[model samples]
Target: MAINNDVLSIILGGGQGTRLYPLTESRSKPAVPIAGKYRLVDIPISNCINSDIKRMYVLTQFNSASLNRHIKNTYHFSFFSSAFVDVLAAEQTMQSKSWFQGTADAVRQSMHHFLRHDFEYALILSGDQLYQMDYKLMLKEHIKHGAEISIATIPVNAKEATSFGILKADKENIITSFIEKPDAKLLPDWTSEVSEEMKNEGRNYLASMGIYIFNRQLLIDLMSNPDTNDFGKEIIPNAIHDHKTLSYQFEGYWTDIGNIDSFFEANLGLTDSIPKFNLYDREQRIYTRARMLPTSKVSGTTLDKAVIAEGCIIHAAKIETSVIGIRSRIGKETTVINTYMMGCDKYESLDEINKNKTSILMGIGERCFIKNCIIDKNCRIGDDVRINGGKHLEDKETDQYVIKEGIVVIKKNAVIPKGYVI
Candidate 1:
């Protein structure tokens, strides 16, 4: 991978992430734990580091306390290198009194800092996407084609196109038309050319991945319009005709884990025989905080294809196809299947656990049955509790739980009463 020090990278971490509600209730979307180890913000920053782009700015607004801590603890540069990854929280100033309204607006507000450096292009990325790409190639193509704006696009299927910004690029890959979250009826006219193999396999639609390469000046000029706040809805569609906008297609393992079902599947998908996304890649390693903890102690646990992170303790529990996160504690007789337990932040010492002998101790209590569910960090599942996800519930939020994308999402730090069945 070619290094580009002249380009600045920006990771958009400011979204409220309402679609990922309970997970976003306390921390920002990017701060949400993923795959039993890393946070969502690590994805984009890791990609930038592997691509050799050093300078980075993460824009955040909602519940940034934890996000800021994670970034501070994880990314640090030696004095020998100029690489820096800093978080730019939203604040009111003399120039602007309001917070970031959309993605484009967030970048515009933070442009002052990005422009202070002598960088040429700005590589804008999403915080919730899961993938790895050599942005050096994308920037090289942007400069090679003399494009004012180059968008990173991925070929998505029709079912997935409705949630994304679909586009149409002409013969030379210059984008001609774009639609933001087009309805299923409108997808017919927005189709692009596809290969015969893809035609036979059914992956055909070309969707904008919300990743863009912008010539610093063009981006600044485009942001002059106060109405162009959103990149997909207001920015790209208006710039395609006026600017030399090109499409850089990316064929990689990219998935938007912005919703409950997507998040659930993405975490559990890591346990597959052959995971769609590889986290163990040596070259493009996903970086996170270096936690010094003892090895996970597992004794006679009936485990099958589960990913148990460090600092976890599992007694004779039965876990199958689950991703138990760092510092997890599973009691005996608990059967967890197809679940993503984003384990506790810290372990309860034995004395503390003994003190709480009256009620169920922290972590999964004994004899609990959990399936197709997402148990957020610091959750206390009591004994005889059954979270078996049988019915397909959607967008139903309550004090006890929420069911979105047909998956039961127990809110973070929630406590389930003993003998409760759902």
Candidate 2:
């Protein structure tokens, strides 16, 4: 593989993912299970690997141990080579600094790290998006156009456009106007630039993918600008006129798995009759840390549009449109639907009373029934327990399980007693 010494990939994986609720209460969004097989962090890391960009760093905070372990196991570089991947955490470099304040601040905090490396461009991306793109092509375009900053923008529906950072690009593809999230009327008329079919195909309004290719020195200079401490809210909008920012029009499978609906939708998208996003391309395989376990086994169970990862045992359970994480056990007569079960990973390094036990490892309780809920890592549920549509009862103040938006959240390393209904 040829090395692109001028580029360094920086992935932002630290967001709290509050909107994803039950799924993110204990772990960061990047570590959240996706399609029952891979973590959200796998998306960007897989993209970088497939794009042939090896030098990468993931910036993370807020329950990052699982995320860090996933990255360490999934992304391994040869010791004989100069190219490598690293995960960066918020650490006190000096007595003055404490933790990353924002995305811009996260990058700003790593100024010293990149300062030692000689890279001409920095490829910044989000860890919580499901998309497949050839970033090498985008980088080539960035260098060819001599762009100070390049943003990955895709057309999204106007009705759903307010959820993203909307932009207005000129005829030459230069970004002229930018808004984090605009009202419907305030959005630019992308119809003229795109086709009606595109709009119908979930494409019309240009939305930022939260992916950027920044001229290294220019980004450093921009970060040094005390007036700006945020990217989408401040620096990006501020760079509209002063910088040669270009919008790279991307039309492909792209979904921001930021909220619960989007997260659930993205997971369900994987089981589409003809999935929009393909992670099984042999030529451009999406790589993740292998669990080194046997493939999942189902005994007299029925699975419909579900994703079951390795080392899982489904015993006569009915699973539909859900994602089951690693090392989980689904008992007979149990039903799981539209839910995300995050299994216990030894990599999480949480203290557990059960050793190498599937139920104890991922925090799932034996014989418990989960439905339309998100069970966080390392939760122990006792036999014959009912999740009740994954709904949580708010009346119990001292109880550990909290429900948000009709989704029940079982925190990491939690223990639910036997026969108890949550």
Candidate 3:
């Protein structure tokens, strides 16, 4: 088997997603549920596997148990010994402090693993995103250009440009200026310095996709520097002035699912009449943990544009534009609309006490109504409850729970008693 030399993949899965609130309060942002079934980590891992990059590592911090389990089960490319996929955690191994302070810090902590590889280049990416591309082609361009660092970039409309890092490049596709999330007024003049020659030569201005490929030695030396602690805030921007930094144009279906609004929007995108993401591609299959279970059976139900996973029993529930997870049972006369429910596995030992404990896991508990709410994994809801998320609107005063864009998040393991309405 001929191996592709000079490239390695590192997925940044650290960072406490405080903005995401209760969803991320327990697990890292990358482990947070998406579309009821998939986690944020699944996006990048699927991309890497489809792109034919065998050896990859997920750098993690914060709450990592769920993230680790998802990686282990979903990414089983290692069933064949020739392939290697791993989840790397922050460790205190004879080299400085343990915790990951920032993105660069996380990579620096895992320097030993990269150091062992014979590959000369490294591809660094974030796990909390949805995109599909042939990274093998990207790597080919990186090596062909002799770039010390090559970044994948996309152009955004000027109005929404402030949300992302803006890039300024010169004529030869050489990146000169890189800024992570600039102000709105700074947008107009953000890339004003670009010469006409650069613009005419198809290399005017671009925004980074937060994807990077770097020479191994250059990355190691840069990461080891005391001052360079963050990739976005520090390292990459500084490298432009000193190193041969280049930009690779990325025209694909890419989305940053970092916050609640974006997360919900991305899931909605998947279920569009003509989806931007093509899941049926046999050539580039997006792999997930396929539990050997029976197909989802809708018991004379009316499902409208809803994604139902394996082992689900929808008993006459009018599911519309929603995403339901595995092993979940929907009771009679239920109307689930614009909602996401991550279900739990069925228990073999079902005692009376266990029945009370695992009510939500088993079924919707008769007449429990949920509208416009995101119910997380393993939650229990009792009978005759009318919970509408319209009550708690987005507020500026308190940080308790803000319902921005009308998406309400119910935390894991929470129980709503019978007839309780929100």
- Choose 1 or 3, whichever is better by TM-score: 1
Q: Model 3 Cα RMSD, Å?
A: 3.9
2 or 3: which has the higher lDDT? 2
TM-score of 3: 0.89
Question: Please, what is the whole-model Cα lDDT of each candidate in the order they appear?
Answer: 0.87, 0.75, 0.74
Candidate 3 lDDT by residue in tens digits, 224-277: 786567887888888999999888877667888777777766776666667787
- What residue runs in model 1 are displaced by over 4 Å at the alpha carbon? 1-3, 195-197, 354-358, 392-396
Tens digit of lDDT per residue, candidate 2, span 181-294?
777787655432555668568666778888998988888888786555678888888887898998898888888777876776677677666789887777567777776887
**Superposition TM-score, candidate 1 onto the true structure:** 0.95
Give the poorly placed runs of model 3, Cα more than 4 Å off.
Answer: 1-3, 77-82, 191-205, 347-349, 352-363, 390-405
Task: Tally clashes: model 2.
Answer: 6
User: Would you estimate the TM-scores of all the predictions?
Assistant: 0.95, 0.88, 0.89
TM-score order, best first, reads: 1, 3, 2
Residue lDDT tens for model 1, 26-88: 899999999998999999999999999888999999999999999999999888987899999
Q: How many clashing residue pairs appear in each of the predictions shown?
A: 0, 6, 0
Measured on C-alpha atoms, candidate 2 has an lDDT of 0.75
Clashing pairs for model 1 are none
